[model samples]
Every structure is written in structure tokens, then in C-alpha cells.
Target: MNSLENFSKWLQEEGRSSGTIKTYLQIESFQKWWVAEKIADRFEPEEVTVLDLQDYKQFLVQHARNKRGGRLAAATVNKLLQVIRTYFKFLIETGVISYNPALKIKNQKIQKSHNTVRWLEDKEKIRLLRKINNPEGMKNTWHYKRNKAMVYTFLMGGLRVSELAGLIIPDLGLAKRRLTVHNGKGGKERDIPINDDLFQALSEWMEIRKESPDEIVFLSQKKGKFTLQGIEHVISKLGEQLGLEDFTPHVLRHTFCHDLIIKGYALQVVAELAGHEDLNTTRIYTMPGERETKKAVNSLSMGDSF
Candidate 1:
């Protein structure tokens, strides 16, 4: 067996996820290609050269074919390079390789365009909320109340879909009007504040929750916990019925941040409220719309408009 096979075995022994192991194996394939085509033999711990590394990178860009039979994209090639770099670092740390040849290869920088944040405008938000609350035909439907509570939690509390789904009776602090979210991303916990609107919605939903106290807060009609896909289907169906575009849970999150920013909340406060670990991650949610940009520019004094 080659070093790649040994590394795969080691990764499995270390309890790495299948996805991670698969990505590492893809990197190992690139290394095998380097040995077969560029170096004329397997790279020993300390015998690989920077020139050989550069040749492998060129092969990734000019010759590598994706599963779709297309040339590898710059982004995909960059990801492969990152995987290779990480593997070499791991090999060095484990004393399997004395020198990290992959480190000598520079990654191709891919420029990112400003992504358009999807959010509901204020009027659209109000309209959607009212529509969900007062569903004309469905007077006593479970979907009506459930969707209303879901939208309320997202807009008012800024809870992610996962956090909302994972909620339990113990997570709610009725007196304080707060929710304790456990095991958020990165295994972090946070208490998010709730307003009267959200409190009322939760109270209404609680009247209908027939499960035990330890059961999940949100449940489907089948009395099972609502999955991410289920929530997505609800949002999409509602969006279509209401003639709205691109309505998803993430769009609701964007609306939460956009509403907060427009109401003059500081970026740091918004970041904390959104449960983001980094302020930079939250900054993406604060992109101003046309009206906001106009207001900002109009407020600036340009010294007699030179």
C-alpha cells in the first residue's frame, strides 16, 4: 500500500468524518498525479522540490477535469490546493514528512463580487406577516400558526432555523422574555431576547404543543420534530402562494439584520444578536439598500459640492 492508503487508514482510526476523509483522499490523488507525471517517482519526506509542486498546480488548472467533464474551476482548484496544504501540514506534524512540499505552491486568488443579500422590504415584511397571521381560507390550520410562529421567531428573535428547531420548553424564559439557545454553531450558547410580538406567538403555539416538556418546541403534523427541509418547504410554498420571490429562512435572517441596521443599531450589537462569532461575518448582513445609501450620501457634507 502507498502513503495515501496509510493516511486514509490513519484518518479513519482518528474518527474523522467520511466527508473529510473523502476530501483528503482527493488531495492524495493530486499528490499521486504529481509523483506519476511531474516527479517521476513518489515524493519522499524531504526530496520533493518547489518546481515539482508548481507543476502539480499547473496541472490542476490546465488539465484537471471535474466529474461533469469540464475543466476545474479556479475556485475548485483553490479548494484542492487548500486541502493539499492542510494534508502536508498534518503529515509534518505527525513526522510522516519532514518538509511540506505543498506549502511552496501559492494558491490562486479568486475575487468575490459583492453578494446581494436577500431580504424583505419593510412594507413587504409587514404585508407577509399580516398575510400569514390572517390566512383568509385557512382559519384554523396548523400551518398558519406554525408558519406565523416561525416567521415571528426569525424576525423578532433572529434565531437561526437550527436553533429554532432545537428549542424546548426549558429553553424559554417567559418572565424574562428570552430564549436560551444551546449547542449553537461551534458548540456555543447564547440567550436571545424576545419582544412582545414573539412572546405572544410562542404563547399561542404553546397552547397547541401536546408533546412532553422535553420534546422539541417545533413539531410537524406527525408530532415529529421539524427538519430543515420541512421548514424550507413551508417557506417556499408560502412564498409562492403570496407571490413573493426568494423567500427562505436565510432571507428572514437577512431581514432581521437589515431591519436592525436600519433602526440604527451598531454593527457589533447586530453581530452579537445574530450569534455570529466574528463581526466580519455579520457585516455581510448589513448591506444597505438604495434608500439607505441615498440617505447616507445625502447626510454627508461635500464642502460646497466641488
Candidate 2:
């Protein structure tokens, strides 16, 4: 078999998802084309050269087409390059190659625009909560309560959807006003403080949650664990009812950060509370909009004012 087959087996052994493996295989197809068209038959792994990589880079830039019949995006090409580089590194480590040819390949720089954080305004938040509490909503009474609790947890604790979904009965410490998040992103565990609002919501939810301690904290109508898709669906439905645009769970997280920033909490403190390993990741949420910027500028004046 070829190197791609061997690398696919290695990725599987390393517990990579099938989707990831398939992406890698697609990248490998590009490399195989380079081998067939440019490199001679004797060009084995050890015999691969930097010139071969340069030729491959030219091919990618000039002729690479995605499945959509358009030129491959810079991001996709970059990912493909990363996969090849990783494969070359593995080959070097395993003594299959003396030098890593893929190391010298320079990826195209793709300019990324800053994403404005979508957060609920104070008025919008109040309106949403009021709508949830209204008794006249057509149906899905249990869903309203469950989703209210979900949004409350997100707003109060800044919990990621995955982290919230992974929560169990033991994770919640009502007495101490804390919850232990297990294996969050990058397998990091941290303690999140629970406020009175979240605690009260939890208390209310617990009356129903007591039926299954082994199950997730959030349950479906069938009393099973709440899937991520289910949580998203609830958010979408609520957004439609409230006439709000893009009201995902992540917006609740942004609201948590925005409220804290407005309350004059330090960025470092917010970052810790948000379970962000990098402070820069938390900084994105704290970015002020044009209105705040104009207000700040208006607050300043020349010292020579009569």
C-alpha cells in the first residue's frame, strides 16, 4: 500500500474521528498527484526533496480544485498543507525519511476579519425572560422552563454548550455555590462559581431531575440526556418567538462577558470565570462597539474649552 493508507491507519490508531481521517486522505490525494506527475518512480519517502514540495505548492496554487469546482480556499489549502506537514513529521520520527520535505511549504496567508460578539442587550434580555415566564405561550410548557434554566445557566456561569451537556448530578454543588467542570476544552478541569439565580434555577430543575442521577442534568421529554442539537433547537425556537436575531447559546455566553465587563470586572477575572486558557480569547468578548466608542470619544474634550 501507499503512504496514505499507512497514515490513515496511524490516525485511526490515535483515535482521530472518521471525518478527520477522510480530510487527511483527501489531502494525501493531492500529494499522490504530485508524485505521479512530477516525481520519478524511485521517489520514495526518504528520496523526497524540497524541490518536490515546491513543485507541489505551485500545483496547489495554480490548479487545485475543490469538490465544488471552485479554486480551493486558502483555509482548506492550509489545512491540507498542515496534514502533509504532520505526516512528514511522523515519517521523520519513525525513520522513514531523513528530512521532512513538507516543512518548508509556506501556506497562503488568509486575512481573518474580527467577528463581532452577538450579545443580548439589557432590554432584549428582560423581554426574553418575560416572554418565557408568560403563562399564555401556546405549548411546550416544560420546554420553556427547561430552556429558561438553560439560558440562566449560560448567562450566570458562561458555560459552553458542551460543558453544560456533560454536567451530571455530582458536578453541581448547591451547598457551596460551585460546580466542577470536568474535561472541558483541551481536557482542562476548573471550578465555576454559581450565582443565586443559577442556583435557584437548578433547585427548580432538580425537583424533576431527581428521577435520574445517572443521566445528564438537562434532560429531554423522554428524560434522557440533552443533546447539543436539542439545545440549539430550543435556542432557535425561542429566538423565533422573541423576534431576536441569532440567539444561540453562545450569545448568552457573550452576554455574560459583556455584563461582567460593563460591571467593571477585570479582563483576567472574566477570562478565569469563562474557563478560557488564553486571555486573548476572552478579550474578543470585551470589545466595545461603535456606540461605546463614540461615547468614550465624546467624554473627552480639549483642555482649552472656554
Candidate 3:
């Protein structure tokens, strides 16, 4: 069997979704590099080694061109490396290779500031809520109410847009004021409790949302299941309306975790709520906002403050 087919079977056996399998397959730069560099004279999995993986990482940094006419972003490069790492791990398990050479290859370092993620300031959040509560047009439309609930879920529940899109009717635990995120990153599932405001918003939206044949909780303009991009665009529009610069799903999620940390929530709690597999991932959200950072510096008396 071909390598792709073999990898596909292994990923499926490991419970990766079909979409994930397709994405992994598309991350083909490593194979291209192996062939082009004459590392093995031909693309053979068993013959690959750590030195080859190391060289390919350098190639990605210096030679790879992104679609926008720039070097690959650190995050993108790291994602590609992750795919290579996983593929080699699969090969090792299958005995295709004696050992996994990609195991020790380090990912590219990405500065959190370079990520361009920002959350709403307290005033901005208040302004957004006020706008949701007092819409000038459509005082009674489901679309307006649905958007309000969605926005609250993103901020308060710290849900990713893809997770929100995957929700079903049963995922909402209204009586208990919690929602089950069944499609979190890496297919991990977690339950997050809703704040009173979010509970009320969701409750009101559910009352107005027209029932459809599909079990999906969120719906699009045509009443079909909501798509991931649709949720992103909704937040983008809200950001534009609120004068939030470069607003997106990650920003809302980061804002959620940031607010929690500043409010004295424990790291473990925040990590669980955010559905982060690693506390290190959650720690990135703790990076201080400009206002908070400035306040911290000012709070410390300068040297020789007798």
C-alpha cells in the first residue's frame, strides 16, 4: 500500500476525524523537501533521519514562501512540523522506521505578541453587551438574539468558533447552566458552566430560534447548521461595529481567559474551562494587556524609594 493510504488508516485508527486526516495529508512539504534535497535519493520513510528533519526545518524558515509573498509565519511552520512529527511517530509504531527521527525536532518559537490577539477591554465588553441588549433594528428577530448568545458564549465560555459550530441541541444544559463542547481542539471534550448573563442570553435565544430538521443548535441565514467561517464573520462584524481592531474568535477566547486570570481564577480552572490540553497553552493568555502592564510598572516604586 502507498504511504498516504497507510498513514490515513493509522490516523483513522487513532480516532482522528476525516477533516484532520485531509489536512495532515495536505502538509506535504516534508516529502517534497526530502525528494528535492536528495536526502535519500528517493522518498523512503524508513531511510529518514534526525539530521534530515533538522535540515528541513531550516529550509522552511529560509526558503518557504507563503501565499501572501512572505516567509511562513512561525505558527504555520510549527503546524507543518507537527504534521511531520506525527507522521514519523506513526511510522515508528508501524515498524516502518526503526525510530522516530522527527521526535526531537523543536518547533519554531512564536512570540505571543506576534500572534496579534486582543480581547475587548472592560469598557469594550460593556459597549458590546449594551449594543446587543439595545439593537436599534430588529427588536425581536432570532438572528439578533442568536448573535447575542453566540457572542456571550465566546467571551464567557471561552469556546472556539469551531466548537460552537459543532454544538447540538443536547449540548446545552440549560437547567444546570452549562454546555458540553464535544468538538474541542484535538477532539477533546469538556463542559463549561455558563454565567448568569450567558444563561439568560442563551435561554432567550433558544425560545426564539426556529426549530429545524437538523439537530445543530446554531443555524445560518438559510436555517442550515452554522459553519465555522460564519461564526468568525459574525464576530468580525461585531468587532467592526464596536470599533474593535482586528477582532476575531481567538481574541475573544484570549480575553475570556485573561479576564479569569486577573480576577484570581486558578490556572487549572482556567485551563479546564478553556479546554486546553496543556496549562502552558493557557498561560499565553496571561500575557498582560497594555493597560494592566502599565499599571503594574507604575505600581512598583522606582529605585531608592526610601
Best by TM-score: 3
Q: What's model 2's lDDT at 226? A: 80
- Listing every candidate in turn, what is its Cα RMSD in Å to the true structure after a full C-alpha superposition? 5.8, 5.3, 3.2
Q: What's each prediction's TM-score?
A: 0.68, 0.69, 0.90
Worst window of 10 by summed lDDT in candidate 2: 108-117
The sequence of per-residue lDDT tens digits that candidate 2 reaches over residues 162-196 is 88888888898999999888846645678889898
- Residue-wise lDDT of candidate 1 within 1-306, one digit each (tens)? 777787778777766655567777887676567667655656654666677778778888988899999988777887788777767776887788787878778887655432456778777787788787786799666667777888888888888887888888789887899889884654567888988999988887777675445378788767788888898888888888778888888888888887888888999999888888778667765676655677789889797889
* Per-residue lDDT over 1-306 for candidate 3, one digit per residue giving the tens place of the 0 to 100 score: 888899999998887776678778854667877887884566888777789889988988888899888999898888889899889888888988887888799999987671455777788878877887886876558789889888888888999888888889899999988899988777678999888989988998888884667788788988898878888998899889889887888788888998998898989999999988789777876777776677788889676686
List residue ranges in candidate 1 displaced over 4 A.
1-115, 212-214, 290-306
Report RMSD for candidate 3.
Answer: 3.2
Better of 1 and 3 by TM-score: 3
TM-score of 3: 0.90
lDDT of 1 at 72: 89
Q: Which pairs of residues collide in candidate 2?
A: none
